[model samples]
Target: MNPLSIERLKVFPPVSNLDPSIYGPQDSALKEEQIICHLNGMSVQQAIEENKLFILDYHDVYLPFLDRINAHPTKKAYATRTIFVLTDMGSLKPIAIELSLPEKNRNGPPKCVVTPPVDATTCWLWQLGKAHVCSNDAGAHQLIHHWLRTHACLEPFIIAAHRQLSVMHPIYKLLHCHMRYTMDVNAQGRQLLLNAGGIIESHFFTAACSMEVSASVYQNWWRFDMESLPADLIRRGMAVSDATEPHGLKLLIEDYPYATDGLLIWSAIEQLVQAYVHYYYPEANIIESDSELNAWYHESINIGHADIRHASWWLKLSTPNNLISILTTIIWLASAHHAAVNFGMYPYGWYFPVRPPFMRRLVPNERDPDYTTFLADPEGYFLASLPCLDQMLHYISVLDILSTHSADEEYLGDRKDLSAWAGDPEIVEALYKFSMEMKKIGKEIEKRNGDPNLRNRCGAGISPYELLLPSSGPGVTCRGVPNSVSI
Candidate 1:
């Protein structure tokens, strides 16, 4: 439940030793006592100094809509914040979670910080609290993390590419594979997945407010520069730049499968793009004089994502280095970034308790009637708290479809038309080199999955993280990086 799936789970900004301004500060209800006990001999401040503390905070984003959400007869939710400590083993372990209702006056602090029950007799209540948090995480995962970042944000780039670049353009050919089927898939999603009273509303905890929540995130957190893997890791305090480290950055969690493997794929793409760009635009003047290239970049920034088009952070494409970096980030987003978030749904979430999409009941207090029902039959109450039988089936079916690959799926580096670039033997050779690197990455991923030292992927009962494995057969194999957002 780190940034890949729960993208809003940022490193606790106030305590971060590096780039504390990456995310703005918020009022923290989490106390040091609740966290220090689980820090494995390290003090809470020491962990923060070492960039080990992280938070999945949903307080401000969801608090504004909780009343409207809870008013729905059958749906309920809480604005939750989960605190985690990075273990020595390089995996996140949850230390505490705080759930809250709206402040009575709308301007004051939450009436009280409602933490998970601690008494031994109230373990069921604790479990129920976690379930509510999972519901919040799952909803945000699907709507903002997956949809808004990858599918919605990438559309403008695709549109601008088609309008500006011709099929004969080298940049167009380079991106064609990654652009396949995206428009069609996005169109279908709009009509089904994101439509009002559609699958998202019916299955996710956000219910009627699903798109509203996504818009809020886009307005507040989405940025084109940070969409790149390296920038994203740095912004989240998951890694820090170091000249001596691999990829010139050291990951905070050494066993983070996503960062380890993603860096490999990301570097490979960068190398291939650098080679292609250098071959075409040998000098800065060549890049500056390319009308089609300039047109594509300007349209993408000025017309497609015009809201931040004037922002100083947007990279100017006057040099080959700049173009290469931009193209690499875009391809990465369409393939690996989308793959990391989209394909893991079934493997991690199919077991309903692990990630319930919606909660049917709120955590009950001692005075509440539902408290009696929970105590009498905790298991039954837990089951009843989840989406009903029909809803569960509906959610599972959607996950299965999203996770599955088609028989003819084209994975990253599986360029069937390498011959299309045959006119330029250098470009074809670069493509061949990229294809080979992807195959090697696949083998390396398998090797890591078998290495006992990486407990996150190799431990008993842990499914190896293969969502970025770069290849898979047809079916819900929970592996593969398709060339585009074909799902």
Candidate 2:
């Protein structure tokens, strides 16, 4: 295990200390392109969602000097943080969209549009990912890399963001505390580090099904105590046998509906767990990454559960969907298991526990009742939690969901309340837009491969019309069951 050191988390060139001109986006065309998109919209969310970004799973993207977030720093000034952004543009729709293809016969100037202009015509689901920064760059990198090596974080893309409000890291303060050197250096470098952290904490881009970045760290950590898990907990099923199913499709359509009745929370967490494993594992994997986690689907995969891969995922269902289902299932399992195994039942999202000096010595310490305790609720907690703001829903809701959390706090929601300091509309927009560029490589791949065959698995058999346009022929139903749910 790598030691936790302040040196490992420091930023280099101290853009805060040095000049912004020093690190130009000239060579970083992708970065440059992202900057342009960022300047266009009112909010980061609107800009990215408008773009419709789709990321290619194989491509490895990182900061210029970053080799690995988990690797020990070779540089004297450790760069502990980095940010990620996602845009909805340049994804599957890019393939689906009609564009003038390069004519085989014509060698002249082709009139194909390189990219679409920013406008209303885009997928709503393709919105921006929050700006994310990784302070435990090394630890996080290591953890995710480890999971990925074992075939996790793949089926679903990994997502995270920096805190809402950025601030100086402990390492930064330590380095500049004495200030024998100019204060300028500390200030600038600190700002960069803080911003980077904010970007990471903003991993709003994590596929909706796979919220891996720590958005729910408190809840998850609390939920991870193995003792909390009921031994008789039904190992697998959409929901408990006694749970009542929702009444109508309207409820589901309005809310993100699930195929399984009571499986909403269950399915969600299971998917995230699979993502967690995939995230920590190494890529260039022929089986896991390439095969969509075929190695471990049905043989009873578990989140944070260290075990060898199994071929059972394939046996559970057909090809791709089987892969998708198993991967989705794993994330939910990991998260849900958090409630049972961890110290707290529901991931104490904002309610953090003390980190014991020694991992082996970590024993549960009951919350002190002698001192004033804080409850993340509609009551008891601050109206705004600051003693100076609005009502109950604002504070409690923030803890309950993403919209509220991002609105109130999210940045340093991990260790400390950093959101107040990290909040920056400009940065958030940039990150969301950045996610768009992340998908460039993937879009190019589909362009090369062209359209996937429209298979009629249930034996509608040979729809020649798939090759035809909507106006030209009949539109076909999607593959498999009219509607299906994963375990």
Off by over 4 Å in 1: 1-26, 105-119, 367-369
lDDT tens digits, residues 37-150, model 1?
A: 787788777777776777776776677788888887788888887777777776777777777666552322342233445774467777887898899889878888799988
Runs with alpha carbons beyond 4 Å of true place in candidate 2: 1-233, 236-262, 265-324, 327-487
State the lDDT of candidate 2 residue by residue for 438-461, as single tens digits: 233224322322433212111233
Error of 1 at 126 (Å): 1.8
Best by TM-score: 1
* Residue 99 accuracy (lDDT) in model 2: 14
Alpha-carbon shift of residue 12 in model 2 (angstroms): 56
TM-score for model 2? 0.18
Residue 361's C-alpha lDDT in candidate 1? 84
Provide the lDDT at 17 for model 1. Answer: 23
